[model samples]
Target: MDVWPSLREAAARVDDLVAALPAPGARSAAQRAELGTARDAARTLRVRYLDAHAEMLYERLTAGTQGLRLEELVEAAGAGYPSVVPTAAQLESDRGRRQADKEGHEIDQGIFLSAVLRSPSAGPHLLDTMLRPTPRALELLPEFTRTGVLRTRSVLLERRDGAAYLTLCRDDCLNAEDEAQVDDMETAVDLALLDPRVEVGVVRGGEMSHPRYRGRRVFSAGINLKCLEAGDITLTGFLLRRELGYIHKLVRGVLTDRPGSWHSRTVEKPWIAAVDTFAIGGGAQLLLVFDHVLAAADAYVSLPAAREGIVPGAANFRLGRHTGPRISRQVILHGRRIHAAEPDARLVLDEVVEPGAMDAAIAAAVERLRSPAVVANRRMLNTAEESQDEFRRYMSEFALQQALRLYGEDVIAKAGRFAGRSG
Candidate 1:
């Protein structure tokens, strides 16, 4: 008369049956046929039970017919499943294959529709977030392990001036809960990129609002370099770690090592540039690697190695090479952030516009670079810059300096500053 235990057993059997279907070759003939029957029953249950069909079907299958055995289904599904899960290496290799075969896409049909219906006013932040990462955006990406999402978004629009623009937005997140949920918005973005509706490789940042990273956990500023390092093992860490290899491949894909490719040219891709509200420490380092820099006139750009009792890493190398060693040393040693009055003559931006004018400036620059000839000329100039061995030496020296600085008394002093801090 106690049906509860019987139902539980039946559910177990059903789960096994479904799980075993992936490797049907391992099943006995009778078990295979039984699985087919159970599957059919599941289909029927789907239509009949509607709301609780899955649970009902699972119970029915696990019940194991002594002859054909509802219990056998559960046993079969469980037995055929692998014990060891795929490793991060395996998953990454698989993910890369999938990504290379397709393109990153954005899922914005709903957002787009909402924006259209709502007639939302687009601000520069919104536009920047929505814009895709251009080719050669970053030379290196770090790798992390955790549940993650890789998303790409792109939008094409014609300016009123008759110029066509392609925006590639790329944003990724990891450690998301509920993998099966419809709201893994990155999946939608990936679908868009893979679809032939637009040029492949175009990407945009994925959904900015997901329950996991939304509301009470909005991105707060004051996340300085050390805090950034701590969070490397967090969501941002996973995103960076997972995509590091992909970033490398992308750079190699576009800038071949072979002669006469973009890598070998004296200039670089004309439209390649970086514009951001804040590029501090590593962020600033990465941006300086760009051929063109656009910063909000008020955007704080700093290499605060001295402030942190450490040496700047890549930023020191890149900026020092871009400017002379003396200027780079002064900036890094003094923790000199760029003030509003600085000139851009030292291999920085051609001009730094007022905060509101940045978007316009970037748009104008992109328009100019759309020309193939201009891009080619820029590549030649950049290639000339790249050929300087002194710059390469600088990066090497900077790396060494950073490693040494981490152990210095300065680092201890800096650590003292953060000892009692709370977010």
Candidate 2:
């Protein structure tokens, strides 16, 4: 069959099904499963069509927003959901809900995200906008001295002993990454880097509530797959936002408007990751970016996003630096887990402490990382490892690739399986 006709038909099926579904809320478990299958086909066609006409659509969508900074560009799109979205998405309730929910419109957002990065002028402008602290960060900065604690929905930042303890607090899902965590983590990191009292930053996960790992601190379980199943994780809100947001800030340091490259004139600090039980998928990706890592003796790390049909953040780009190409491929492609105290994790783990000794380990690690040369050499090492331009290029492609993977059949199927097993 011809591509246009098939694409149109596929989209029609989704619209028809969505219109017929109950409006009180989302579909039932079974209905959602049905929708999942249909959405997969529809997304595949739409993504292909979008890719084919990316240039034409990109020019029109970004015309008014051209030359605008990243923050300004989104505001220009619209106050909220309507702006930057396609006519087709605008005409439907699901589209409106998706935009409102901050989980839909990945196809357009993907293209727009890529266009912004690929543009010669807007690229740096976009990077500058994202690399800086969020407005929330500024708001919380004042409170830092009062409590030396800045708390967000999914993250907690505490300033003490000259170290900013940046704790990931999502015990409900073993500290998995969701949109909320992504936003809050960025804010916390900003507060840490901004604080004059903080000489170093320490990242570690909170205690888990799940019975299987009850009370144990898990580094992270990666993207909230259950949320992924519910279609809650969005390309713009989570995936793309993260690579450029906190994760980059963690590696690049919090940036502000300056005359020179973002790398220089920095407020950056060395960070140490205290890996607890495990750092799976996105968690594992985080290990590659830290200046130092202290993994629990029993802790292990793995990149299993590919198994779920999703990109595991920047792990693909930076893992090779820590684990070589062969090891990176094994972990990323084959879902290999590198346990601490083993040869595989030796390069990544600065030290592997017993689970009970984590606090002492972190305290010592903080002091070692606070050496003046650390702050002095952080920017140099980060730039040498992955320059802003190199990252921009990676993100330019990742925007499109991850958008498709986020909505792929395999992702949906795996999410369903996870939900079922949990249920």
Candidate 3:
């Protein structure tokens, strides 16, 4: 029997079937399922062909290196839909089966290669060939990226069970400048809150500054607003921008003049804001204005501004009202990190999650806040006799002092030391 002609005919039949299916966006459930089966078959056929051609074209394809750095190409590929990613055991078992099936072939390249063909480059080319993301998985990507600087190069993605998933780049170790990028990122999140479509907002943990720690460069301890600056005093001047001034006006628009914008509401969409991973120092304080707080089980939320020889900006007054005199005194006086379990803790973190459980925690928190019962009656009860007056005073001083404190030599040095990135 002429096997080559038979193989070529079979390959042509498979390609025809693949081409006739509806596009990813339009595929019906049954069509999608059939496509999945066909894709698996096509992948196997590809590996068989490649192995057959290897004797003549192998070196050219691999460029003198080990079998075409498939792993590197997979690393570069963009996200697909989130599927139920298999555990290591499942992948191992699947690989074994493929290897056994290919053992009788002329050359057994590997089962992994037979299972999928991840493109060496990323773009529409890959999307057309690979399985499409489930609608839910596609929804998460834009929501996650809309609020911060998700370095496209660092996005980690996986696909399984007809879905796609994404996480920060695996090698996403933070440097000082990266942390500074987060500060700008949070500001972007704050701006996005003005949009009604957004239900939750976040700026994931990242390096704020690049300073030499003991001996190596590291991300600094707090949000680094330095990147927004143009000159020596530029970061200090960021607050004076009309855009920032608009934030102030928006807050003032609702609650005349409230310290930290706490107890204020915008005419825009309602939202539940959250921060994870070392939401202390400036990071913690910045979040104080949010309507709700969701933290990680291991998250360290605090305010250490006082340790640098300054009070807790307007946070002292706003947070004092939120948690009362005792807890506020503890935070302001000691300049300590507030673990989620502290009694009468300021900001009253609504929920806590274990390390790596931020997504689940965020989902639960957002879902709860979306309920009419939760959003209508805020948990706070104001008691200060001169609440409005005091809040106004604090906002004014907060503006002036925050400007000075952020750029002060002492604060910068402390931030550098904390981030392990020396200024």
Best candidate per lDDT, number? 2
Q: Which portions of model 2 show Cα errors greater than 4 Å?
A: 1-75, 78-92, 95-104, 257-263
| lDDT per residue (tens digit) for residues 166-224 in model 2 | 88888878888988898898888888888878999999999888878888899898888
lDDT of model 2 at position 202? 94
Candidate 2 vs candidate 3: which has greater lDDT?
2
Q: What TM-score does candidate 3 get on C-alpha atoms?
A: 0.44
Question: Which residue runs does candidate 1 get wrong by more than 4 Å?
Answer: 1-268, 271-276, 344-347, 388-400, 406-416, 419-423
Residue 65 accuracy (lDDT) in model 2: 43
Please give the ranking of all candidate structures by lDDT, highest first, separated by commas.
2, 3, 1
Off by over 4 Å in 3: 1-187, 194-196, 200-203, 206-220, 223-236, 239-266, 344-347, 372-390, 402-423
RMSD of 3: 24.9
Q: How many residue pairs clash in each candidate?
A: 50, 1, 23
Superior candidate under lDDT, 1 versus 2: 2
lDDT (Cα atoms) of all candidates against the true structure: 0.35, 0.75, 0.39
lDDT per residue as tens, model 1, 1-423: 433344344434554665554443356678767865653443333223322232333333334432111112223323431111112332233232211121111111111111211222221112212222222232111110111223223222212232222232211221111112112222332222222222212211122233443321111112242332322111112221112112211121232223554544211232233333445554455445443556556555666667766544445545766778877776788866665346733355555677667557766665655565754554456556543333334432432344334334455455446533532
